[model samples]
Target chain A: MENKRNSQTIAEYIKNWSRKHSLFIMAYGTGCGAIEIPATLTSRYDAERLGIRGAATPRQADVLLITGYLATKTLKRVIRVYEQMQDPKYVIAFGSCTINGGMYYDSYNTINVLEKYIPVDVYINGCMPRPEAVIAGFQQLQDKIARGEADNGTRYKENLEWYRANQHRVIKNWRMPDYNW
Target chain B: MAREKETTLYIGPQHPGITGNMMVKVKVQGDTITNASVHVGYLHRAFEKLIERRNWLQSFTILCRFCVPEPDPMELTYARAVEEIEGREVPERAKYIRTMVMEMARLQSFMLWYGGQSGSSGLYTLGQWSVGDRNYLLDLFEDLTGGRIYHMYIWPGGVRRDLPKGFKDKALKTMDYIEKRLDEYDKLLFDNVIFQKRAQGVGIIPSDKAIEWGVVGAPLRGCGIKADVRIDEPYEAYDKADFIVPTFEGGDIWARAQVRRIEARQSISIIRQMLDKMPEGEVYNKVPNPMKWKIPAGEAWAKTESVRGEVGFYVVSDGSEYPRRVHVKGAAYTNGVTVTEKILVGQNIADVSFILNSMGVCPPEIER
Candidate 1:
């Protein structure tokens, strides 16, 4: 029913997403790409218009946005934030780090893919995707929300587990594609 | 009884309180932080341990990741360390380019800090302007180093590559634009009344404590300590470039922010000198095959003034193709962990983020 309504009414869909957009986001900046995350959330990009906000506490956040490469050490925090977030939440993996280990593939300590540890609904591609791209990722998350695919439910939980099992397989490290670098 | 009374809060191994990879346990009574134990090694894939396995040249790329925010200093310090060990002199031209790139990174780092520090105070306008202005500089870094943040451009021999044509002119023009925007921020952030009230008397540290605690960069400078690696111990083109190290006597958040603002203006001066007295030569000296270049067995401590504070790399090589160990004796350990916990004790809950930003202690740097 939600999908049908979303497909039928795009304007109403956007309005609904906008109304609840003040998503408390975890700072969660891990790599070189983090420099731009600040750029996107601020006035120039104005992530607030969509209700996207950076949250100091995960319990308050509606979105868990990961910007760029996250080391294994950082991965634990990502999980904690994901756990703290309310059930009806969304996760967007920004830039190369969140999608795939952009440059740190085969790095001694880095986790090549983020999907293993946390449930990510959307992944934006770029070495460090620009602030413009971050906003675009947010809009796509809203659209996904409208479609009801991104709603926090049993489905998102199941997908998070699936990705964790295949985390290494999902990310390719050219240094040691087959393993044992 | 004490443990039960204290509320334990975990900050970064992945928490929003600290940026990057780090987790600290803080026990707070009411909103005041009481006890803090910083737990690094979250991001420590053992960078110091790994450096021993890779050749001298290939190790450069890995070192920059240690301090992701202002990576140029890592590259510069490592290169200088290697140069010191090898007794290789960087060409005059390479020095100019290195100076320019380093200053550019410094300026961008300050701009980014301006946003984070002010935003922590609930001053969003600084966040808006500083981050936007920083992109203009990052664009320059992107053009110069090919990578925006971790420019593996600075290396042991000298630098990885020379400036592309018109880069000098473009960088100078960008500096002018950044200077104009700083004035706008001065009005919005520096001169604003709210920032003053929130940050003025907060996080007071004495000069003796600042030195004892190993506070370098802006925090040390804010406490009226002119402990800048660039001025006290000049490296690269720092000796040639004329600029003043800005300091403040307040020893508070406002003082630290002021030092950064003043330094941003001086970074522009250094960049202009780099361009005006630009040397003409190759960017890098002859570095051996990256996969097999062994550094001679020795220890070299190279420190550079990053936007945050003194960023230094301590490396020891065992006459192998790789380094024996590489340890960082930088600002974050003291500022991010020890001092952050100490000063946050009596402050309000709202000042936590602001205090962290003002100190410019990125958690990953400390944790790594």
Candidate 2:
């Protein structure tokens, strides 16, 4: 009887939460892993089941999923896009690419690690993990959401050590990116 | 037009005109580009680093993400690189199969390019017909490789499976369908005078500049510089297959489009030849289990004539279960950003997308 009552209250809590927040995803699929994001979010995967849809712009996104690696050429844009996302945004690093430079680790123009640059809440492993795995990641994010764990505001604003270490391998002569702006 | 004394316009990373995850910061005076810096990494997966961490076979699946448009070239290059290290000889039949698959991939990619190249100039029909027509090829890919987009079928020793029963016949029929559709494309795209006017004199890359710019594939060939991996260094069954490296001297978007059109024809011819001359033998030579496959320590550079220019995989192995280094040279670095910026300097804003489309700059290649 208590179990039923608890479940009903939890359902009510979820309903209130859904009405208050519409999850916006930065459906950023960087590599072959990206091909599956569309499949999962469309009718097949129905990311809408969790009230998530791909946002047209980063500023509108509630979550930024780094689906693949962070290369030098793409890093600037990644940073820019991450910045454009609203304050309460959560970053989901979708594949091995986002965790560590999965490949292209030694290229002169590429960055080997992603975690150093962005604060990732979820790391889904797979060179290009399957759509099923992607759905699982989404479910996990939803669980985090159910707990009402909103953005910390401190994590990204204050974190620079990880980003600096990952970029140390690149950035010849250790010239820091202009941060005064 | 020179309004702002010093202005910076960020062109991508979130721009609709550019495909995939990439950004080009272009400083323009009025409409003409003054200075440009190509920024990449939005899609960089540190592929070389990742491949080093994974076993040889696992890397195969990872390789496809390098060039989304023509991923097979990367897969083929990685497999051949491993073969070079292990000294594994692919069966003659497997070679023929590889040749067949490569040409088909080339055809589909070319078709997609044709649409993009034309669609940029407001010719939407070409994009519609070709992209939809491409579904036929994707269907075949799905049936044989189990994945429509990334078919991790080609491996070190050989392909994953022999052509499925009736797969060859179906492929031939698809070829026929594509051939029939090409005329419609020709009429709607290349044969149209507006296309000629819009593409002919735009984005000229002279033969002298071609080599200096490090251009490859169709764009370089379009300038009359004869450089094709298939001719310069034949891999798989390219040596046995009879086809010409199509070239044009126009040195503009028209030339690039023309070279691709002619090359598509060459790809079709090669596909027919491979099917006709396909030898009877096992498609796959058994290799160590993927879970335990360890490559001997060595470094080698493998290049393939992808739909894009010279796609290379420079791999280093340290006699371990995984590669020590695997750096993929996606054509985007040179063709996608560097060259596009150089040529886009004097071009109008309207022609930017058109010229980029003609260059076939798949963004993931740049991002990777």
Top candidate (DockQ): 1
Cand. 2 TM to true fold: 0.74
Chain B of model 1: TM-score?
0.94
Off by over 4 Å in 1: A1-26, A30-33, A43-52, A55-60, A68-74, A94-113, A125-127, A132-148, A156-181, B1-3, B6-17, B20-26, B39-42
* Tens digits of per-residue lDDT for model 1, B1-368: 44487788776554555655556577788887777676776565556665666678777767787777787888888888888887887988898888888988889888878777666666677768888778788889888878767788887777778888898788889989999999988898768787788889998877779888778778999999888878788887889988888888988998998888898999998899889998677777877676776667788888887877888778887888777788887778888888877787777666777777888887656755
The 0-to-1 C-alpha lDDT of every candidate, in the order given, reads 0.75, 0.75
The alpha-carbon deviation from the true structure for residue A29 of candidate 2, after best TM-score superposition, in angstroms, is: 6.3
**What TM-score against the true chain A does chain A of each candidate get?**
0.75, 0.76
Error of 1 at B200 (Å): 2.4
DockQ of each: 0.37, 0.20
Root-mean-square deviation of candidate 2: 6.0
What tens-digit string does per-residue lDDT give for candidate 2 at A1-181? 3343245476766663773256788755544566456456644456667787767678788877776665565565567677767666777776665666655554555555666677777778876666678878877676655555545234777766656565555554553355532
